[model samples]
Target: MLVRLIVLALGIPAILALQDGSPWPVREFRGAWIATVANIDWPSSHSLTTDQQKHELTSMLDTLLDQNFNAVVLQVRTSGDALYNSSLEPWSYYLTGRQGQAPSPYYDPLEFAVQEAHKRNMEVHAWFNPYRARSGSSSKSGLAHNHMANRFPQYSYAYGNNLWMDPGAKVVQDFILSVFRDVVSRYDIDGVHMDDYFYPYPVSGVSFPDSHTYSAYVSSGGRLSLADWRRDSVNTLVHNIYTTVKSIKSHVKVGISPFGIWKPGHPHTIHGLSSYDSLYADSKKWLELGWVDYMTPQLYWKIDPPQQSYPVLLDWWLQQNKMNRHVYVGNYASAVVTKSWPVSELQRQVHLSRDRRDQLSLGNVFFSAKIFSHNDHRIGDLFKSAEYSAPALQPEMTWLTAPAPPVPQNIHASADYRIHWSGDSSGSVRSWAIYRLRADVWELTSVLNRDTLEFAAHPGYYAVRSVNRLGKESDAVTLHVGDITVGVVGKK
Candidate 1:
């Protein structure tokens, strides 16, 4: 039986029932996030053992795999502190009891997490908070070597004791770029990602306290006013990061998850709290200018939210996406309550986005991993139940098209656990996805960076498919597990 395609934005009534159970449209993007700040998602409050931390992460990965998700947007540096070992920033205090103090049993969280995610055939995007220096409570603060607050006093600004890297300073932008470069070069993350927290979320009564930097900027003949200067500084970093990511690994994607409403619509209004206007985040400009590969606007409100209706904002975000960069809506699977929702709130929005007519409206990314752990809410499984039968690869940028993957062949497999295989090239295929059919379910098991399709079995039914340019996955070839028998002419 085909899984139900969500009926969210199908628009027409007659098409509703007809499209039901029609598998998700091809070329969709599906993913979830794992936040590390304040130990919100993983390591469960920073009170667990190192192994416990790993176990929690593994379970999160398993859940994503079960849901057939293809990517994870993981927070690697939540607040200028490194979740993994860093030569510059200190080990995240959230990982250990004290800042800069290594986990009793030291390990590289980013490397370990990315490697594990890769094994599961999922893309892990390293997410960072470039401007946040503190999340409150300096009890765990680190005064280690090269700390931004210490090394560059002028480039850092204090906002209520907690520090923020001054957006008016060009050097601050350079430092953020360095962080992205360090991670992208050192780890195998599929993407370098950031969130909506640029410019400190705009304190209603209090300003960013960047006046000192601003004064210097003005005196130095900077061409912009404070706001414009702040924006340009951030834009510089954004453009720089995008260029750096592509330069290092052409396949690596750079993306941002910005606040849903760009600007509010009013008499003299757009009627929304926009990152573009307030946070000085030119998200739309970035997308239009082609600085990044994709954008996931956090449409966190309910379908008909008080200020911004989900449908209106969704369509608005779509309009901004005319540049055709991948536009994945950030889903609120965690139900974190941006506002108040009635009983059927999240359930309603889920229906809206998943079934939009244009497959390009495609998939979504959940906010935090905890929602899917142990299938806690069962909503995660509910998502897969509506998945598209085939994974629709994100369209190729043509500008960044690498070599295509050759198709696999040999077609050798038996019910009795024996297999053999071979495949050809498309000149763009850089990887292959392996899967298995257990109890009538076609589940993705692992992704391998290889040219050959030949492989051994592990005792159950299996399949392997090549992935080519534009992230499109070829059809899977079935294989058996734990071969105790010999190969023969058979179906792939």
Candidate 2:
């Protein structure tokens, strides 16, 4: 009889389940990649008007927000061109039809993306391709006069249908570093991301044509072999980028999405192209050295394949995290669209990652965002109904040191059942968490942006808390409500 009465008060079996210790306010990094090169994802085309471009981006963000994703890895720099305004590099040919053309009536895409994403309580990570100077399809005649290839022809060479800047040159490294510094200092981005394009992927039997740079290094008394020298150059840049970004903004995360397989036969069953030898990336060393805040290995394979099995590779990557940084598995959502892979395959992969969350397998990032926009095979619907049915906070990085924001103040409920609150004066709060009590247990109902101070409410017990930029939550301020009056229940 007591149990029945408790159930009646709770009003639902789901609320009762919370009393059994089901986790509330789940912490996970749900992210997606938004590629811009060749207009693969956003803008749909380079020739769209500024308003059309803005609408396309906001629409995509709305879709992700609806599905409860927490982060977006947006490719801001592709092939030495800028998606946003820049004096150093040309406007991306992929952003406007011409290589150096800005949007009609000119609005910075990165700035707009950051603002819109924050309004939706989602993170925007700026993605850069480090060494590729020009993609294969880009025409030399169409290259902007100020493009890196045209300005420093001596440092760039054509290889495998693309123009690549010499990674071994000191000038090239300094230039890339400048680009990183420029973006970090300018935008309020949550993270700085680099994909697996450190050195261009190998071409069949074609050398990288860096003999001139290599000869200079050898004359300067460098003793490492060709392969080791290449790897060392990449390592130096990776280390410098990590330290540089931290020096500028310690809270900003530095992440890398290296190719899935570190080395063929790493786990005794895996076999694939070796990013270490072929691409000169040394990604495993970067993680071991604690240079990255998170590592998103593009483990874009099926679960059952013995050679490049998703679970097998995922386990190996987790085991390699001696520094205990985050490892968010990168899924190939485009595969479901292009190759007709079953949606269940992606779901099973997500379940596998969740199964190992205690081991630092914290989340998943899809390869491209267009899959969600297209809703191919109903992937968006399935994820919304299953893995992303509830809202989640981005997993906290414990290494980051920031004091929690002050608790929300003046929390009141009005006659219309609307809740209102005031944020801290320090301006450190990034979001607010609203929690409601059911069956004597508190459950997080929503996380809203800092600027949003009110929400529709119901006649119930509620608590409001402040969340800081570092993902730290402040103590709660509670209110008990009725049809006519709201009573303060004090802090939690």
TM-score of each: 0.81, 0.93
Alpha-carbon lDDT of model 1: 0.68
| Candidate 2 residue spans exceeding 4 A from truth | 1-25, 439-441, 483-492
Clashes of each: 28, 0
lDDT of 1 by residue, 26-71 (tens): 3456778888988878878687888988888888888777666778
Give the lowest summed-lDDT range of ten residues in model 2: 1-10
Candidate 2 lDDT, 87-130, residue by residue in tens: 88999989888888988888999999999999998999999998
RMSD of 1: 7.3
